[model samples]
Target: MTLPAKAIGAAAFAVAAGLSILAAVWAASAIEGKSLRGVRAALEEGGYTWAEVAVDGLQVTLTGTAPTESLRFRALTAAGAVVDARRIIDAMDVVDPSALGVPEFTLEILRNGDGISLIGLVPSEGAHAAIVERLGDLAGDGQVTDMLETSEHAEPEGWGAAVDFGLRAMEALPRSKISVTASRVAVMAISDSAAEKARIESDLRRRTPQGVTLSLDISAPRPVIAPFTLRFVMDKAGARFDACSANNEKARDRIVAAATKAGMAGKVNCTIGLGVPSPDWAEAVAMGIAATAQLGDAVITYSDADVSLVAASGVAPDLFDRVVGELESNLPEVFSLHAVLTPAEASETRDGGIPEFVAILREDGKVELRGRVPDPLVREAVESFARSRFGSTAVYAATRLDAGLPKGWSIRALAAVDALAHLDSGQVTVRADRVKISGTTSQPDGRDEVARILSDKLGEAQGIEIAISYVPVEVPEVDLPSPEECVEGINAALTRQKIEFEPGSARIAPSASGTLDTIADLLKDCADAPIEVAGHTDSQGSEEMNLNLSRSRAQSVVQALMGRRVLTGNLSAVGYGETLPIAPNDTEDGREQNRRIEFRLLRIAEDGTTVPMALIPGPDTPRPKARPGGSDSAEPAASE
Candidate 1:
């Protein structure tokens, strides 16, 4: 085996290289085994019961579900820290098995640039606090964004300790003295039964807790009265009050007894009537007639007296005196010697041709008269006699007669003027008794004709006086075009413009200039009418952008119209944007058809009708954008 020194050195180097390669392979195998064991142990310790761990060389990969994000992070950190592992890849789901059935309690933990966000629902306030505390500990210096919600459920006991609540309701009224129960309480009172019941119930309910109920019962006493009866009768002939009558005494005794028993004291009335054994019929009749004549309406009999009178309409007061005097003279024996005649009531008499007249009886028993008089001679005589006899006792009772016409009398004149005014221009003023007509018209002959017609129609009415005056009537100038005419004009303009609107956009091609010119002419012709320039867009862009574009387009149209001498103030611009897209935006053709600009007649003063003017395409030429080298082009040049 002995050889030269160079040969030995070369052989030794080859052997050493072979041994170094073998040792490197053995170290790699040991590190791989150690890393696998470390990962497996970490997953098991972190409560990832279903996880599988694998390690290759310096890399550790985890595949499993951890109970919480903290547990997953801890497991990954532990695996990466192993001496053999250079990198770690975690594919673990931090999901709690208990929270699977409770979607509301499930939480998602996300780490953002700013902080950690916790989003989910908790079972209770306690649960939420616990979650926050646990996450706060894990977060350390990081902020936790909590978007958790509370679970709605019945509160546990002891939650209302702040409120002083008692087991039983406080006793208000006594129980035995009154029928008392949970819902209802009853009481007895000798007086003010209703008031006492209400007061007690109110106090009890006010003191009662929020969750309690209440009811009330009361018993009231009845009023006492003394029982009694009375009887009386009317005699065949007559009845009168007599102090010595036995019937009167009996009635008085009964009344006194009843009053004494009922606790009342005062003057008590008692009725009396004649006994049975009637008087002779012939004597009764004669006495009755004599009494009637004396009393001016009274009856007299052997045992009774009654009075009655037959009044005459419009009879003079002197006639009453003569009749009374005659009765006194003829029935001196039956009538009282002091028989008197007095007017029962005074009243005014009303009849045709005679003003309302009132008669009075003087103190010396003479007649007096006052009121309106139909004849001068009669009036003078009545006034002089009344002043001489009654002095200042006479009353004025004159009646006012209405000679004016009724309310509806003016209706006839109104009808006549209305008919005539409809046919021609004129001003008519209606008064209580007459109508005045005057005003001028463009046609003098038409004014005269209207005045004649009104006069003829009103002359027949005797109640209303018609006064006709002819003057100039200023008619308002009717230069405004009708809605139909305006619409027709707008349609004609649209027809001439060959280029129709592209659905909703206001962009018009070069071909539409002629139509736009026609529209300008129509607007100029209908200067009085207010035109609304509306811009509409398809539903392609955002609502806000579309709205702005529409508004800008509408204003552009208004500017163009103004260039043609159309008053800008008369033309208002409105943008409906994509809200009122006449055509659908779903298809390319439909989108192109939805965008348009339209001129609408908003108002017409002649007939107060609003008509849509017409939809006309704007200039279809694309607006030039900035280009390189200062050249005008439709497309914008690319920036450097």
Candidate 2:
């Protein structure tokens, strides 16, 4: 609104000033828009995707996070390209360098008849090409499948040597799996035979680089033993060992010595392998061959520890028996001997129609005379010989006088009585044609002695048919070892192999059956013994569960022994559970050792009081853990 002259002048000045202010505001907005567009274009061209750009007036500002400090600086430089370098404001934050971590690396190499395969993380230094090239050079015609990934981490120390060693090992191990790490390499291989297996293991161990640990598990197929047998045959021609399986080198040497001694001719090749009953294998086999050799025409065979010897019917009965008895007594505790002494031929048993005389010596120390004696002179001489050989108080004359007696009847009868006197209980049969003497004695060569005596007496014209046997005193003899000794032996055996049960269960494992078999064999010699079969367990489960499991296991062992024909009449089973741990249960090995089976002997006085048994320690005895106060019932045992 226009008013007067003075008011008009003031209006004009105000209007001009308002127009100037409007133009400046519009120009400033245009400059800001242009600066923002230019900075954005520079940033896009420079590839700063994470950088944020803003404009106010002529100043350019940044606010977004940068992947790295270098990227952030490049973004600021790009913005300055469009404006003065001082006009750009750097507010961008770079991420922490540690946020991007070093990579972890691993590798697996698999080999088979088909070819080789590689998989897993590896250092990117060689990339996939270098590793594949190395594999091709080593693997030869084997197809190599390279499926590898890589990381930027620096290669670990010793990584190269370990990888090289691992690959070389894989070359030797045709069918194998190799796991490689920075410091360790594990190789598993299979060979067609044990010889090859040994070679593979030896080669691998030699090639493993220093500072690198190599775990090798090389395997071979089990040798098939068609019947797991051995046959040692000695005949009139010679002696030989066939299919002899020795437990060790010492056993082989001893067995060979035995065979050669019995006339085994030529080189003996005994196979050494896993199946052997005991360490005294050679000694037992040698003695067996010797027994067969004593028998003229015979064959002795062994299946594991079962020994069988068969002699032809015409073999001297006394000799056959003496040889067999010696073999039985000399054999190791693990062996069982079965001997067959066929009777003499029927012709040998028939009478020759000659005047025969027989003398019988009973177990009661009484001597009975029968059959025909020569004239009174000869009869008296024969009776006098018996009285001289056996004490006069023990001789009884029951002979009839006969002039038909042979020329040397008196001499033969006297010799026969002298031979009979050496027997425990036996008979002597004499005839003009032939003299037959038979009896049992403790003397080792008692059977062959009669022939020499008769020959000396009859001027080598008389032939004596001898049938004598020798029986050694039984083992553990009439006087048994103390109960403590039996327990010690059982415990020592247990230390070799513990009776194990299934995990989290009371059932015995199959591997335990072998140990149980050994126990059963031992108990057979202790038939009269009252032994305690106690079961123990690790501290793994609740006391009640462990107690129940231990009891079941002990009962199972007793039943198993009984199944093997062991006398359980004097055997009992008990459980101690986790209360009696032999070792700490914290470690896996300790826990395994803590779970065990123990045996103890029970002795009772005539008054029914329990008597603790103890034994002197030596090569024959193992030290007792403790002397139990009572029997293996609900009471606490003396030791673990």
Candidate 3:
């Protein structure tokens, strides 16, 4: 008890150090005890008893074994919370429940503020939603985020309607979206483009569904334009002509008056032609000379200014002449007076005299002489003389006129010459014996000269007979063979076989071998023809299996044909399978017949020989029916 001050201080320090050590050890033991209790509680709840727990101060550690990774995680988590652990060390081994013969259900929950996320392969939409709702209930007011994956579980028989209802529900929300995973459908929405995308989303959503989720990402518009073309053609007559002449004082008056009467204006292009000068030949010539003197022939010939009184609307010849007379009286020095009429004798004569001929001179310096003459000889003589004088370049034959009369009659008479002058170049028409030749000539008196020649010739010919003749031309026709005939031949050959097959099989029965032999003969007959062997089957069994079987049957036929010495290259095997069945498959016999092989002619040579064996149908025809004792039935002879 009696000690120095320093020793007393040292003793007090040692006691305090021991107490601190004891407290540290006790805290460690308490932490370990709490961790063990938490671990035990977690293992019991999770149905695991083999797991171990340890603690060092605030650090908790889980060890040993557990039923699964989930169980190990749960044990550590429980221990950690109780010890208020600063750290958790996991050294536990997880046992796979599948390997241990235990059913496993995986649950994952994610929370971010007011949003929650869930993800796992679920059996159905209802189960997935139920899990989400449970999590939501646990989270209380926090938003639940779901990213659940699902197995492809088929929707129940009547659940399609329920799925459609869910789709409708999703459609109601402007930002709602729905998609299927496995048999389960997930729904979510959160943007402004959701309403438009809803229609697509609604189509995809299902209460009991499976497969990949469908998404709508549409965000743009389209464009349009008008369709057709309008067109028109100019009339170039009537009102159009009136508008063109409206500026001219005299011509405008006439044209405007005509247009007003017709009631058509401003709608189309008008074309006008200079009409015949005048009804009175002598008067017309006099008027023409006067107009030519004042306005020059070019202006007078403008078509509009050359209007004839005979063609003028609302104006009689007498009235027109009175107007002309008054103008001539006032401007007598500007106009000349002369008879536009031809000489009286010349008018009466069928062939006009020299004076009458001069009066018909056109403004362009050309004249047209038209009349009938009586003598053929005169016509021929004048025509010959004119041709000799002018050459073929200047004199053209327009037409020939034949008046019924004795043969070899002179064509040079007045009647014959008149008729000759009216013909068009190169035109020839036969009537009776009298021939009137007419055409344009270099000389105006050519017609008269021809008439005189005809008269002289007619005097020589008393009586004779002649016959008309013409040659005929012929063309040859080409001959070609018909495609239908060839196709018919092939069909006939097939029909002649009269072989039948069993349903869903390509095995040709022993009975059908005779038909095959006949087919072989047909092939031999068409040695040069290229053939296509095709196999067809009725719609039965899986598509893949049917196609394979058809191909095998077709190949088998090709092999058979090749064995018969048919050229391999000439024959080609093709399997159409159910695609080209010739018969219906709804009935037993129909299906039997439908499962068959056929040979078709692809091509033939011109010589009808050297047929390519490849073109022959393979022997894969129809299989015969099975006999009662499992023996194949024999096919009848092809001829029978």
Candidate 4:
């Protein structure tokens, strides 16, 4: 091993150099390990679990898909905090923000007497500016508070239309809250009255843009009533309320329920308003209505705290007294009752010297006037007025001239005649002190009309009694013809007059208009009947050409009928294409017969196939007279 002095020195130096290289490598590996561990720990502690960290030779690299750029940046800062900033490498990627869902854009505009306030997110700054400007213009003297935020997204479909509609609606309703979205606009407002509410709602609905859903919550405040009034009557004509008023919804419902129980029918509109005599107004009204119903024929009127009850002329005295006593006893302390028992013959004068006038209207539309008139001139005027109302031929006047009659005797006679005109069959009696109208009418508000006429003509204080009853007018049902009959009838018309068309063309001739008119008239009564307008062609052309030509002809006929104001919803056009020939196509006459259009009755089978409907035997259905050359095979004529 020990050779020479020079050789030994060289070997020693080489050994020293190899030892130094190994030490440097070990220190570098230790530093890299320490840096990697520190950076990974820092990222984990900072909640950047998505980040991947690696350190190689003093350089730290971070790689991963971070949920956001802020998160990625935070991870890098955290890694830098644990190591040298210069050694850190950012290989991290933030997730694409476009992958996230688009934000919803909405706007709510509230407008009141104070001002307008807008709040919500908009698609862009343009939308925000448009909304602010529109609201500012609407505000006028009031301030517009804009709290709308903008996003840089595109405007959604229907957003502009809905916003414009909402703004228009807001303009219409001064005090309203409008909520606008891409597809809907909701408006909540208050109106001055029920009529105003209805008008506003109708206008808003009519003006709503297409594809935009509209929601409306319009309310009308209760009106103020002075000397609140309610008048209910239960007479021979059934029961009804002449005038109804309540303070609130509950009170109105209670009053309506009482009226309904007392035999009132149909919808009853009870006014809910401000002035009420007492909180127990509904209670008093219910009790009064019940008592009137018990009496059978009575009238009750309420004016503020004063109540009046009047029994009919023929009401049982004992029953009237008992009901009136009960009603008065149970009424609220704030109410006062005035009871009146009409005499049996109160409609007639107590004195025999009071000249009476009467006009009787019969169901046959004839009027008979018999009474006493003031003079000849007055009598002529009365007769002339009666003739004008009841028709010249319908009137028969026979009144004795009386110079000593009352001052308004002519007026009373004329008024009686006028009132008599409204009754289907009834009479009007005019006395010196009262006017009595008794009749049946088809008008639902006949009694009210008569009362109004008397009040307007004679005066409200004049003694007036109405016994008008409403009788619903009955409508007679029409018997429509069966589908087979309808087709047969149409064919019958076609047979008599052939619906001629241009040679080898679908154009209908002008001469065929009369036949079409006849058929159109027949179809009006049975437009709902299913019918097939089948077209046929002779074997003179290709099957396809014949089929298309026949179909066009059939459709042409249907269109012609439609032009004549006939309904074609149930009519279908079908081409036989020379398939179902009634006659041989070899001869001219046979071909003529084969090239005709026929109507077949249609019926849907269980399998959804349309088959020819069977002919129904109907002897009662009148058939038109057949011409000399008309075909009488029960099938309608096929026209070319």
Candidate 5:
């Protein structure tokens, strides 16, 4: 429709521009609608819905967030897989890395007879193999069930440390269920005993990581107290409860207050126990403890609901009766009372129907108590006291049940125990009102003290016999002389006496008997000393023959000593022959001396060290080795 030149030119230019725009549009659509779309579809289908692809002209671009760098790279590779590797335009942005919001990581470990179980998430950096190996070692023959997942994301701060601490705690708490998280670990378990519970708590505290929170709930049931008991004793040392039990704090408070009024001096710990007869347990115990205190030195005990109140021997009968009446009236409905006013400590006033209590002290460090014990509680208290005071392994109580014992028996017994401490060894017999203590002590006033304490605890009319004797200081033992001293003594004695032998023969002449007798006398004194009768010979004959002759002569001397009834237990004869002559064999006199028989004091020490004690044969005993220096009867056979 163009008519002019300018019109035609503009129409042609507009047409060309339209075609160029269509061409660009076609190219853009081809990449975006096909290749880019295919890439996006592939990413989405490949389980990466987070990836987005876009296109401009021939360039393909990626957008949107990638959870991790690996996924981000994977999107690039995915596009490259669909088209030319150079065509992939990686505009993808990875999600910003931040600390885990809640770390909300969890782990549970269960341990039982069957095995150990590990179930939960674990950090990727955690060496799973090492942990699994450690678990396997702990598992031993037992099986281990592991169902754990690891996160690619870096662990939150302190996460690794918390898990490690949790694992260590698991080893210590074998019978526990442990719940571990990045920030906290909770332990639930049962402890076999109080000691075990304390051990577990200590272990967890020591091993738990500093930044992690730990909660431990360990349970241990109350120890059973059979026959449920209470024993409160009042004396000069002030009032005390050997064992106290209360059902509740209210009851415990009341009982404690009453004991305090009665002179309880130390930290009083009353056990809170179950099975209290009634809610009024506190009232009953308090009233019982208070009433007994008024009667003077007393012991109030409870065996289940059966309450026993015993007063000292000298408690006035009227006062005892009034106190008992008041206690019975004030007691709870479930309680029953048994009251007794002990007879005078005088033996004549005591009932003869009940047997006495006997406690024996043995040299073997054993203390035995038999006869009567007031009640189950008193019995247990006494045994415990004995075991603790004397020795846990050495004390034995064989006491028989005898609630019929005289009123003041327990008091006298307590006094007797006090008395026993002063004695080194002894026996205590507690009867109706009489206490008989017999023992030995180094303290001068031991007897008086035993009597004094007994009288003090039992009051007037108390018959306390102290058949105690004072032990004098022991004398130091004399130490026997060492082997060296014995040797010195033997050598000196042999020098004084010399044996004479018949010419050329091993026989000792009759003239030698006097010398033999003298030597034998010396031997008698040093019977414990080891004497070596060494024979020396002059070079008068062949060395071998002289050696034989001297040996025989020495044997004769030994026989003479034996004949004199001297102990030869330690005496031995050894012939030195011509080897160890005291004098030269050259001159007559020197040879005469050389021919002489010599005695050497030999000391064999504990280590077998031999030393020749050149003894003067002082005062100590002497023992001889194999030797013959006399022939009292005739020629003696020689052994060289």
Candidate 6:
């Protein structure tokens, strides 16, 4: 291997240069391998299997279709963690988000006495601002807390319409919650009364946007029963409640249970309401009812903290005394007791010589005040009270001044007049010893109402005899007819002879009474079928006035039918006003046609949904029973 020094040096230099180049290449390859492994491992562990990692020298490259822009950004972040951020190269393609689909947009608006609050995401910032502004206007001095977010996407179909409908509902309902979406709107609200709740629900459903689903959960607060009255009577006609009321469900159940145990059969409707006289109302009522049952042939009335117990003429004196004593002692301290035992035979008057003060209420809402009055001042007061109750023109006073009348004669006369107002037609006879109310009434609780009025107005010790009979609506015994058939028959009758009302009044004209009689006969057989008595008017008056007038006319028809002993339990009175016109209002004949009374069959489901009978599929079916005072919808028939 011996050689010259220059030659050896050149050979060594070449060998050394070649080895250095190989080492340099090997180091670069190792670095690339490490980078590739680290990045690939990082991507896989981060659930980015769609990404493909590559390394060239010191640069790391990500290449593949990412499912989302977020995923693509995530891939770059993962690669950067493994290598220098500056050295990481992003060659990834993001999948089109439009292909995936747009997000769902929703809005929730809540309103209460404290004010209103809005929440959820909207399609645009403009929509968010508009919604907030509308709610703020409605809130007045109340607060409007906005908790909304916006997106840069187009509003979905039906979104704007649904929101607008929901806003309108919110404006009407002070206590409510409205949930809005593209396809549905759900409203939950509280109303002042059952009637008000029905109105709100009907208005909302009627105005719901087309193709959008609407759900309603409207509640009416418990009614405030002034004087908190409850009257239970058990006699030859069996047991019943005149006007039962309780503060809550638990109390109502307890009171009803006591009545049932006291031989009150059938369904007992104990109204759950407010203004309880005492916390132990149920207990007190139960004890009184139980005492009445034990005594046999007795009447019990509770007016606020006052309890009145009257025993029948046949009740044993000893037994009456014992029962009365027990009830009085067992009653809560808040209550005051007044017990009375009738004689074997009720006397006509204190001495059978005092003139009887008679006030008669007729079916036409007229009251005839006759017989006697204590003095001129007493006469004036009695006439004024009668006029106030029975209407100014409806009362006819012809009482002579009598100075020899009893001390409380004026009060008895006033009380008699007041009680007479509860009956459809009745006579109230006030005497020194007793006040007798005898006549027929259309009210289900007419007798009870009269009893309560007299018991409250007169002292508990006052002798009272109520021979008032309920003129029960006669439901003709026949095969049940389908609702549609019933409505068609009614419309057919209307076509032959229309039911005409007095000009600008709800009163059925004297000539129309015969037509009503014929219609009443037809309705007797179809008492259980669901029907809507819709009233429409010509466009001659203000919209609101027309609406009210139409409603009164519709209700008047129902009342007229009731007076004819026809069962109108299934009838619903709805006023379309000028909204539904059968003919052009420009012509007198056309206007006459527009002013109509239509009988439409309503499809009422067990779940309380009301829709037009035509919209319901399948053959028409007979309703199981009568349903009163429900929201209604149906197709109009011939005008009257």
Task: Identify the candidate with maximal TM-score.
Answer: 6
lDDT, residue 360, model 4: 95
Instruction: Kindly give the number of clashing pairs for every candidate.
Output: 26, 2, 70, 1, 27, 0
RMSD (CA, Å), candidate 6 to true, equals: 17.6
Candidate 6 TM-score over all chains jointly: 0.54
TM-score of 3: 0.19
lDDT of each: 0.44, 0.71, 0.42, 0.79, 0.69, 0.81
Q: Give one digit per residue, the lDDT tens place, for model 4 in 1-640.
A: 6699999999999999999999889998999999999988988898989999787898988999998777888898998888989998888888887986667889998988759999999988766876776566567789998899877787788887677778778877888899999999999999877767977898788768789999999998877765576768898778987667888889989999999999999887577788798999999999989988988887777777877787876888888888888888999999999887766553433445567888999999998989888889988998899888879999898898777777877877888888788879999998876788898988654555566466556653355677777786875645778767778899999899877779889998899899889889888877656677878889998988887788778888887886665645457677666777789888999988888778878765444445555323236654333211222211211121
RMSD of 4: 18.0
Per-prediction TM-score to the true structure, in the order listed: 0.20, 0.28, 0.19, 0.51, 0.42, 0.54
Structure candidate 6, residue pairs in collision: none
Tens-place lDDT digits, model 2, residues 1-640: 6589988999999999999999999999998888888888888888887877888887889889897777888888888888898888888899876787755566788888758899988877453555576566556687899888776567787776666667667766778898988889987778898667866777677657788888878777655432334566555556654346666678778888878787777876566566676667777777877777778667676666777776766788889889888888888897888777545433422345446788999999999998887688888888888888889999898888777554767777788888787788999887555567777877543443443354345432233355666674443424455666667777887888888788877688898888888887777665556566777889998988887778778787876775675545456567768877778999999988878878877655444544333222446675444323233243211111
Give the backbone clash total of model 4: 1
Candidate 6, which segments miss by more than 4 Å at Cα?
1-101, 112-116, 124-146, 152-161, 205-214, 346-355, 401-405, 421-426, 436-452, 465-640
In the range 517-602, model 1's lDDT, one tens digit per residue, is 77777776564455566666788889887877776677666655655554344455666678666667899888765676666665
Off by over 4 Å in 5: 1-120, 125-149, 156-161, 179-186, 203-216, 248-254, 274-279, 346-430, 433-640
Give Cα distance to truth, residue 241, candidate 5, Å.
Answer: 0.3
List the pairs of residues colliding in candidate 2: 239-264, 318-468
Error of 1 at 370 (Å): 97
- Candidate 5 global TM-score: 0.42
lDDT of 6: 0.81
Report each candidate's C-alpha RMSD, comma-separated, in the order given.
36.0, 29.9, 30.5, 18.0, 27.0, 17.6
Off by over 4 Å in 4: 1-354, 605-608, 614-640
Report the lDDT tens digits of candidate 3 across residue range 130-191: 45544454445867677775433543442332233333334344344444332344455543
